[model samples]
Structure formats: structure tokens, C-alpha cells
Target: DSFNAFMSLNERAARSALLDIQKALGPFRNERVLAATAVTDMAISSLQRRSVTIYLAPNITDMTVLRPLLTLFVQQVMDLLTREHNPDALPVYFLLDEFRQLKKMDEILNKLPYVAGYNIKMAFVVQDLKCIDEIYGETARHSLLGNCGLQLILGANDQVTAEYASRALGKRTIRYQSETRTLELFGRARRTRVEQIRERDLMMPQEVRQMREDKAILLVEGQRPILASKLRYHAIEPFKTAALASRQNTVPVPDVEMARALPVPATLPDYAVDGPDPRPGRIELDRHEVIDDAAFEASSAENVDAAVSSKERLVVTARKLKSVIAACLSAADMPMNQRISIQDVLAKTIPDPEEVGLD
Candidate 1:
């Protein structure tokens, strides 16, 4: 009784929150979110695993749906790492590109430290540090930077990132030498020795800001900052070949003629029973008659020609309908045997033209 009471409260809270968000979804019209919330008890590890790619196209403007999807994925991956009882699970690589797009990223950043133990690793790709700091706040920003084992900082134009990089490198001591020789009118020259010397940042903020595009700073724990040249992937031997291989040509336009030529599958009883069954073929019409549906029963010769043309069109339409129904049945989630039975019943239920001719 107590457990059920707590569960009811939990359900109420969840429903209120989830429904509010679901109401704003324009793409999921005519569908209730409750059906999506239904859960089945099963072992997650039993499912055949494959690489999961969550590509958020730039065109997607709705963060409400996209953020939840991304959060769910990240949470599941992190959960896998937490399963100490199931250590045999396959390792997962959670790569988040353009990380700023997702909201409430601090939760994920906090889990980064513990992920490695569960065979899960995450790579968060951001354009700049400021982008994340603004979203996750300064505390989360620091935690993220501190937890990462290695950092490759490319040339940064932003003052905040450049200054952060300078501070991150720590201080270095270098010899200072200066000679100030000034000869005033009828005065002797004065020289100053290299007496003023102190520790200074290894790389100044301005220097880091003006760094060459090809140059990057490689920072590793317990190791001196190394200035390295960025790899030119397009020009590299193996990478260049791979890059060219991955390139795709622009998609061609659809063929309207080919689409129009596609025939629909359906059946008509009139064509099956009648002697003349002209369907999906050339309809021989009398030049004197205009093939009018209203004059199908006319006793004149023109009426007879119109009736034949009308019958031919009806048979073609029936065939098209049959094809559509078959496709619909196949697409349904019902069992194969059940679907076949339903389709058979549908075929038989179509009234015979001889028994009930079109009025």
C-alpha cells in the first residue's frame, strides 16, 4: 500500500512535467505521449548493440525535443558504466559535437569522472570554452577542463580562452637583460644591468591569441606545455585518401515521369466477370462520344462508348486501391498470418459487379 502511494505521486509528477513539454511538439500530432512512456521490463544488455550516432542537423530549431533525446541517450550510456554487476558490457564512446546545443549539460559533465570506470568515454566538442561556460556556468566549466586528461587548444582569438590558456600553462622563469643608455646634452651615457628578473607566464595571452592557425598547444597532466603543429588532414597521405573516399556527390532530382509511370495494384469484379476487360491499357473511345459518367446508361451509341470507357477507368482505380490496401496491411505491426487473413477477407468482401452493379 505504501509503495503504491509513492508510485502514484511519482506518476503524477512525471505526467505533469512530461505532458507540458509534449503539448508543444508540432511533429507528433494525433499521438498521445503516454503511449511513448509505456515501459517494458527487459534486460537492456540482451539487445544487440551497434554504434549510435546522434546527428543534430543545423536546421533543427526545436531544442525541446532534441535536448530530451540527447539527454536520454547520454543518461543511458552513463547508466551502463554504473552497472558494476555487469562489467562485461561493451564499452561505449559518447561523442557530443557542438555541445552547446544541449541544455543542462552540468549533469553530464559531473558524471565524466566516473564514466571511465564503467568502460564509457565521452568527447565533448565545442567551438570555444566561452560557449560552454555561458551554458553550464563557471563551476561546471572548470570541472570539465580539470577532468580532461589531455587538451589540444588551437589558436584562440577570444581573450577569455587565450588568457585561460596562459594561466593553465603556469609560470616559467627566463633571464632578463636591458641596457638603457641615454646621452643628455653634455652628459655621459647611463647603462642599466639585467637586475630586474622575475617569473612570467610561459606564453603570454596576446601570443596565444595571435598564434598561427597551424599551431596548437598540447597540454597534458604533469608535462610541460608543448607547441605542436596541427595536422593537415586533407593533405596527409592516408587521411587525404580517406577524406576523398568519404566525399559524396550532390543528390540528383527526382524523375517525375518515372513516378507517374508507377502502376497501383488493385482488382475490380466488373473487369473479372465482364467479357471486355480493358484496364491499364489503351481505352478505345468513340470520337463521337465524350466518355461522360452521367451518360453511362444512355441508349444512344455515344452512351455505349462512354460506358465502356468509364468501366475501364473504374477497373484501373480498383487495382490502385488494392495495391494501397496491401501496402497498408504490410506496414501494420500485426502478425504475418493475421495480416494475410485480413487481406483475404478484404479481397472477398469487394462486391461482385454482376450482383451489385454501380448505380
Candidate 2:
């Protein structure tokens, strides 16, 4: 009786389905298809669990191929944070170097303000405020900047960054006095003194731009901002030696707790399998989906047989499929699965037991 349900797949319907698939897959029929699927180690769960995970772009020259891949990986990382987090877990700090270069993470960054509660921390290393404004626009840029508990500005060579840094550090009120001495012909007939209070930026925009390499601004929540000395790590003890070693090695992991330097592979390893699940009660996530009638019709576009009512269409198509059923029966000697493919284009359905002579 299951065969009776899918009794509407006529030649026109089949052609429509084929055309839809062609349209969807048309743009993907290129050499780049391999590059899209080449990345196999997209397992975000285990990678998120590690003390440190790095996504090294294979070729920066091919940004067309690379940025989208980076965007996909970043999305997976964001998704992992949503579903997987322990209450007692330490903050998983994601330090995005060259934050402006990555695209399509605007939506992800929009939610970063609230995700800090999930033990997720984001350190965006941006060159200037203009880049953030250009990439993410004003609203998302505000959200990203508002979420920062600590803002460390090393150098502000650009006016945009310098201005933003100046504003963020805030203003201070200063009191000063001015005395006016009278000349006989002047408007002031007598000496008078006046005191005035004016607000000035804690650090002016020009001052920020002119800040030396050794100097930096540190802005902390609920505290006065500081113009502090940037740590001269090259002059520091262990860091000095580590910096020397980094010139010879690729990854210069500093001497710290759980700082193990592992060799980055040319291609990330893929531990995924295509076979059926071995677990008894595992949910089948990759099975064929049942498309509803309305959805199928919408995707197929305006039907060729608009005059045929759906019920009549099913009856007519079933009558037309008699030849297909006969062809399937001719292959009855073959395995059931082999015989089943004889006329699959007609419909995805089962043959009645009486029609197949099974009973």
C-alpha cells in the first residue's frame, strides 16, 4: 500500500526534480569542488577540548578559497560553544589575529557579548577601529567593543584608532585660574581673578598617535585608565631566550603551564567515517528526508499538469507506471535490492505483495 502514496511521479514530475537539482548544483560543477571538500578535519568538539588549537591557512595567496574555509571553521567553533560548555570550565580564549581579515563572522561577533558567560573569551587583535567599522559595521562593532573587560592599546598610528582610544580612556575635569590686569584704556578697569573648570581628554588623540613603542594604554573597567610601559619581553629573562629560539623554530610557545609546542601538520587529520553507526541507539542524522507535498511542489516550481487535481494525478500516474512494474517483475530472479532499482525514476515506493506475487 506504500506504493499507492508515491503514485504521482510521472515523466513531467521527474523532469522537474532533475531541473531543480541541476540548478542547485550548476555553480558547483568546477575544479574548486575538490577544494571545498578537501578539508576533512572539521571536527570541532575534540579541537575545542584541547589546550590550544590552531587553524593554519595552507595558502594565504588563495584568499578566495581560504576566507570562506576560515569562516566555516569559525562557525563550527561558535556552534561548539553553544552546545558544549561546563559550568566550572576555564575560559577558552580565542585570540583572533588579524581580526579584520576574516569575513562572515559578523553574526557570530554580534553574540560574543553574551557568550562570555559560557566560559568563552574572545581577544580580537585589530590594527585600527576603521577596519572593524568597515567589516562589521557600527552596531556589531559597538557590541564587540562593549564586551571587552580589558582594552590594551599598544600603538595607535591611525587617527581612527587614536580617536577611539582617546574617547574610551575618557575625560578628566581640570580647574585653572586666569587673572585680568587693567590698563587705563582697556575694558577691564580693575584687576579681577576668575577660576574655570574644563574637561580634557585623559589622553588626547594626537598624544595616542605619538605614543612611543615602549608605551601603551591600559583601560580597565571601573578604574582610571593608565598609560603604562609595554613589557620589553626581549629584555625579560626566559622570554629573551624563547624569542631567540623562535627565529629558528616556527611556533615559539612561551615557557608557561601546559605550553607544549606541537608541529602543525600540512593538512589537518580527519577522523570521520562514512559507514553506518556502530552504536545500538544512535540517531540516524544522514538518512533520506521526507519532503512534504507542499514543499516538494514549491521546489519543483509551477507544475506542468496544473489542470490535474492531485488525487487525479496520483491515479493517472499509477496507471502509467504499469509498464515500470512489469519491467521490475522481469528482474524478479535477481536480488530484491537489484530488482528494486529497475524503475526507481517512476517513484520511491514499495510494491504491493499481491502485485509482486510474494504472498
Candidate achieving the largest lDDT: 2
Taking the tens digit of each residue's C-alpha lDDT, what string does model 1 give over 82-113?
75644665666666777777666555776788
Q: Write the per-residue lDDT of candidate 2 for residues 139-225, one digit (tens) a residue.
A: 777777888889999998898889999899889999989999776765647788999999999889999998898988998988989
Per-candidate local distance difference test:
0.68, 0.70
TM-score of each: 0.56, 0.56
- Give the number of colliding residue pairs in candidate 1: 3
Regions of model 1 farther than 4 Å from truth: 1-65, 85-90, 180-192, 245-293, 296-359
For candidate 2, the TM-score is: 0.56
- Relative to the unseen true structure, what is the C-alpha lDDT of residue 162 in candidate 2, on a scale of 0 to 100? 91
Give candidate 2 regions above 4 Å deviation: 1-42, 47-50, 88-90, 183-192, 245-359
